[model samples]
Target: MQRLAGNLRTIDPEASESLRIVSYFDVLISRGASVDALLRGAAVMASAVVGATVRGRTIRRDADGRTPREETPTTSSRIDGGEWTAWIERPGVPAPLDDVILERLALGIALIESRRRLPGGVEVIIDAGMGEAERVAVLARMRIDPGALVRVIASPAGALSGADDAVILPTRRALVRVRLDRELVPPQKPGPWGLGTVVRADRAPESLETALIALRLTDERDRVVDASELGSFLLLARAFDPDHPPADVVALSALDERSRHVLRALAEAESMRSASAALGMHHSSVQARHEALTQTLGYDPRTPLGRARYVAAALLMRLAES
Candidate 1:
């Protein structure tokens, strides 16, 4: 169809004769040539290129190109008896060829691989410089659970502890004191990193501590911050069961080091997703294990009260074990 200069793979001299004539006419017009004179010259050129017998008529431009009028034979013309018409259209507007093609290629790749990956199971975190609203929009597009995703600093305090009371400020500045554990972070390729999901407080125990410390530091620095810091701290402590351990409440005959290790991982992780990823297991598996542990340890891991008891038991057991 449509005639585009970029799409011109081959040029036909005979077919393009009209185009050349039009270009010449345009140049003449730009140099202060009369419109009527240019039109007459174009007509003469068209006639000579094909034949004098062929009547040169200009039709309005169509969606494809300039459509020519049907020719009528003139009596005193030195031309072959055949219908020949000239078509011309504008020549310089360029389309977005590369962008369209690249987008199509990306869509094709995504379609092919979409079926192979797990169903919305992958976690991705983008670091600072990503504004909150923009980050939310991106995560929403990726189908990631916002509650499960962690956004923090590159330092130790940026990570989350099990404390739900730890606060996150609204400022756009980067943090310096906290760092998330690298183990729970997604792999990043070396490049100009604008954004991606990396380490968070949910990554490890040390990571969680970093988050808490960061919050504490921020709190000590200023008092005008929102409830984010305090809420984070409280939630984190409940999640980690800092004051309760399984050993403190559960009899020594009931649990082992492996079970405690799993519990500690849960307590340390900021979210269940992080905990599951850390353990290299499905979330369901972790939940099932916690359920069984709860039955044996006489407490539920999902409940805040149960977590508190578990922490106490754990601390007491650690003392006894030592």
Candidate 2:
């Protein structure tokens, strides 16, 4: 390696690295290396060629190749330490979507999330600005032609989630978000994705909040619901910020777990016996707990009004933690 570097001191660095790797492969093959060895070596050599071509880089090598490495951005003129020539990004990488021109053709839900553990995979923001034709053009740039999606899925710098069945509506700011996969739903229209609360493509802000609420409440059910279908849960989610939960919500921490479980279980279950069965408790004990909790909460959590509040509080608790 040192001899190759010394000999190629004044050569075009990219060409020099390419020639060096070719020579290295030739040497390995002549020494009776296997096809697998050449295959792996060729892959590494290609990356090294790209690095050297783009950045005039010299890699730090081991007996094998391509060790764990990170390059620090610097402007110093001296080679003070080890080789730090690896380039972090390629030169020809393109942005996902420039600015979309949208159309008002159709609107629906696309539940999106990241395909990997990383964030910033996809981003889309919708307002009254752009039209559907422009949105389709933008999605075309992304190499996705979802047949009927009014918008586009522009995954810029890998910023948007790539799961084909899910759409991540931006619930917070641009970057920080969550990923939850569901195999149970069909894909909606393909387009750029953004996060908001209630998941929909319409103009209602409350719908975005409702989507967030539904996401928080989502379990193993085959169907993921819409904010519009959630009735008053949408209203509650719109009004309720997790940071400052309502007075009754704060009071919940003071209540015993059994009573709290009873309240929540009864709130969701159709009957006391069913609620008790779900909770793994006897029907009689659940009845007692229910009456006690009903008095403590001022309204029975099982009642219409109280059920709404309880569900909202539960969602808020989850939101705050998340």
Candidate 3:
């Protein structure tokens, strides 16, 4: 068995490379090698390759039947450490692991995280702005719903809001944001999920506050699991920004004397249209402003925190002199 395994390792035939990697592992397991060790080795190699490729390292080939590694200028200089080369040199490489194929795996993880963090009406913000082809590629890599990514953009106020609120464009540079309902539904426990919250520093002026103070929520997902927990996870994630205070804390700070008045009018609004009329704008304009308020206030019906924003904005506006 040892001799056979040895022979398998020496053979470099393309047809046998995959078979060798698989059979090698089987033999190692039968010989009492730890399976976790094998897996860790594979993961280490995979991470290295991805880190290197993302940094632009390429394998150089010459007529000597040996391929040396070289890096291209086009490769971003941000590649991680040298551990990846160590993986290739390890006793046996795993089947799914490739010396040069790191992007696929890293992208898979990123895409998975993107889905895990899905926000209502949220989409993945690619490192480079995404296009149809890019979106298709991302979905394929992540194995997610095709419609998962939709176009979004920042508002004139520099808040990361959806473009559908104001102007229309075929392609635009934007950050991803998700919106939730105005009430909180109890979320199921023990689910595949995560939550995050963002808050802005209060001392800064309005323009800076708008730029920095945006709230986002997402569910850190693993395969299909409980719907309720997933929803709750997203709720918490949006509300769990480490840098800023809780959504409620920052939101209160966001509404100064005048903005508080506007929010009050908004909360009292029967519908977005009614809110518009009360704010003294066209219904269409009010809807845009309302949408902006919703983004600013981080109101989602699925969670208690969101409800507070919904209520506070309205109650505050009513106190203002008409």
Candidate 4:
């Protein structure tokens, strides 16, 4: 089809380009591509940024197929597709094919969103932004008891396998699997997973929020973090401001990787000797590194207060990077 389109373009560029746009979206719809994928396709095809607003959430992708670091003024080529609206960001003047791309993009988005509203559409069930009445209706449609408990498991996109009973929805940060708590099984693969606390089906958005936070706290030492076990740590993660992180978080970010690894070991290990063993270094060497770390960080990571500070800084550092 692409070869034909390329050949046809040499004869009639306008008609060939229109055929190309239709073909691009038809293939995406056939494969059930995610909204992110659809927006990225439009962005690339139009050589500009594209965005969609669904359920009060706005997602955008740049022409390079990455989320734009900042927002810029956009062209007025927005198209409404029932449950969602799609737009192109071409600034001064729109490209010739921008209209067709935006039209097909909106059609693709509508098809995906409509399918997600059907029975067993776990996307609607776990969406925090959906109305209570709508959620209850969806639960009834899917034959899910509103009072029954469920958990939202969040992992990197395409990370989970054999999720036959769960609806895997792609969010900006992760792929969330919403399934009944009773049916939840340990993931088959190693994970940097965030397991949300079990909650009533209607309160899934709350679960998803904490699950994503727990995911952010995961590191090499602790690959899986359960939100139910977080306690006060959950509060700290919520209260942290990524845009203006605390001084300790900033300091931790400035250190080299080796220094950060040593600090992580010091924070987790019960003693200097244990820390050295974990790092495969001599105890005396670890002791000297600890002294240097104290001077560099302006705090003793081994002390009770300093340990708490280090833990917060390290976790917040992850949040900032994410």
Candidate 5:
């Protein structure tokens, strides 16, 4: 566990003690711990947390603050998107806590987050320890299709509570996600003040951070904003320096409302056609406007880094005014 934690810390300096405890489970499970052993071990672990709030969405830890299978819902799931949750039964042997005590079976806490509420099912966890056949067998019992799962933490971890693309499920506690949708997108609603970003799922952590950063910058309460679509203010924000006037932002300030609309559309959508659809304008006009905006800004919003800089500038512009 110490060696693994060291390696994990080398990857991300901020990896917490909680992450380490979970990593220990991940490591042991990976070491060929049997399904029965995994099940028994988790039940025994739960006995150690007796009377702790390790029971719900709260972070689970012992009195000494030792973190165990710590799972936060959005803290684990609501990352950059694409997760399907099942409301199912506990993933272990069906002995209730009382039943376990009556039967003299030590009920341990499995590493699943005690707090992530999967409203319809008893909470369960699938240890990363299980083999492909074992995993398939377990999922079959749970009535989940094996083909639909996505591995979380497949991408590198990002900042913000050490957010990664790890799936937070009841029994399928393995770092795998069930694809509810192809795109792990947040709710998409466009507004003059909204923001959105087009990100690779493999880069979910940073993508989540990018969206969250834009969310922090904007003040829109009713609309679900994506960072990419927040318009000139978000663009100007990237270029704005505290000690200097945002000289680059001046380029966008002179643009007409229709042009701004085109840029915002361009920021949110993939291409000229999509931008036109978003703006409810003619594609030729949108293409023309996008080209003009590219020339005017001295960069294309169609590229990833370019779009990021554009949104950054836009966010700073909002900050300057607010």
Candidate 6:
């Protein structure tokens, strides 16, 4: 294909380059290249900066395969692929093959995205809507033992660094990663991540649900939430109504961002001095703030019962926001 493209470039550059574009993307799709690889390939092929937003995750690469500094493109050609988009950045006039490259890139991305969401694919394997028989069939196709243990990790779209062998599915709300329980490792990056309970391969749907719930419960202090550790708190999270939140949740929502931060610190800290240290405020200041919070929240958050109520309200507040 490269020889054909090089030879035909002498006679018809545009036609030859269009053929190259098609052939290049064909190889990528055949090999099941990742979205980042596709972007890099397009950038190198066009000898310009290429970018894409796939399922709300944005990525870019320059011709040298490094992320380009953020700047406005002087000239560009963009193509929309429903939930995604692809584009090339060039200076002055657009490259002759820019349009073809984007079209192929977009098409390749759509195919890969669709393939990952199809039946017997990553998405379906963790889809709670799928029946047990269907999930079992998917597990069989993926060569995973039905009784083998697995866990799901859920995070904001594009948050997790996926392993080559891991099954990653991008949903509307979160990125889902399914890995064998034994292979599970700490997340490679900082995240408000959710770790689901370990369960059989055929029961991944349940894991996904808890993973998402755990994700919703995460805050700045608690970046990773483990569903298995939540105990009865998970039940409370499910029973809480977003439309009609409890009085504490309402009070929490009414507070300013700074006040909310102080409240969270106080609720999670063991003592007033600890909360003050966490907030980087003097003990006197934290004590004064705590007194004001007690008046505002109608409870002393330092007490055990008050801490539980505050924590529950804070978690439920996140669910309401989600």
Ranking by lDDT: 4, 6, 5, 2, 1, 3
The most accurate candidate by lDDT is: 4
Using lDDT as the measure, name the better of candidate 1 and candidate 6: 6
> What's model 4's overall lDDT?
0.76
lDDT of 5 by residue, 40-155 (tens): 33333333321212222222322111233543222211111112121111224432332332122111222233322332110122333223444455445655555542211121
- Please give the lDDT score for candidate 5: 0.41
In every candidate, how many clashes are there? 56, 40, 28, 0, 40, 0
Report how far off residue 31 is in candidate 3 (Å).
90
Per-model TM values vs. the true structure: 0.23, 0.41, 0.20, 0.68, 0.29, 0.57
Query: Which tens-of-lDDT digit does each residue in 78-193 have in candidate 6?
Result: 88888888888887888778888888888888887787555445555665544577678878888888898888887774564455444443322333444434356757678878
Can you write out model 3's per-residue Cα lDDT over 151-216, one digit (the tens) per residue? 221222222233232211111112222222112222243322111122111111111112112211
Model 6: which residue pairs collide?
none
Candidate 4 off by > 4 Å: 1-77, 82-105, 112-117, 171-180, 239-244, 277-280
Tens-digit lDDT track of model 2 for 1-322? 6577667857666545555544554443333232222222432433321121112223332112223264434311112112222222222431121000000000010011111112211122231122344334444454544242232221222343454422322222121122221121323634222223333233222233333455454433313434345566555654655557777777675677666667778998998889988999888888988888878777778788998777767666654443
Model 3: how far is 58 from its true place, Å? 75
Ten-residue segment with the worst summed lDDT in candidate 1? 46-55
- The per-residue C-alpha lDDT of model 3 at residue 55 equals 19
Q: Rate the local accuracy (lDDT) of all candidates.
A: 0.37, 0.40, 0.33, 0.76, 0.41, 0.75
Q: Is candidate 3 or candidate 5 better by TM-score?
A: 5
Best-to-worst ranking by TM-score: 4, 6, 2, 5, 1, 3
Q: Candidate 4's residue-wise lDDT over 241-321, tens digit each?
A: 676899899899999999988988998899888999999999998899899989988999989999999988888888778
For 50-104, candidate 1 gives per-residue lDDT tens digits of 1111123222222111123434333122212233222222233322232222232
Greater-TM-score candidate between 1 and 4: 4
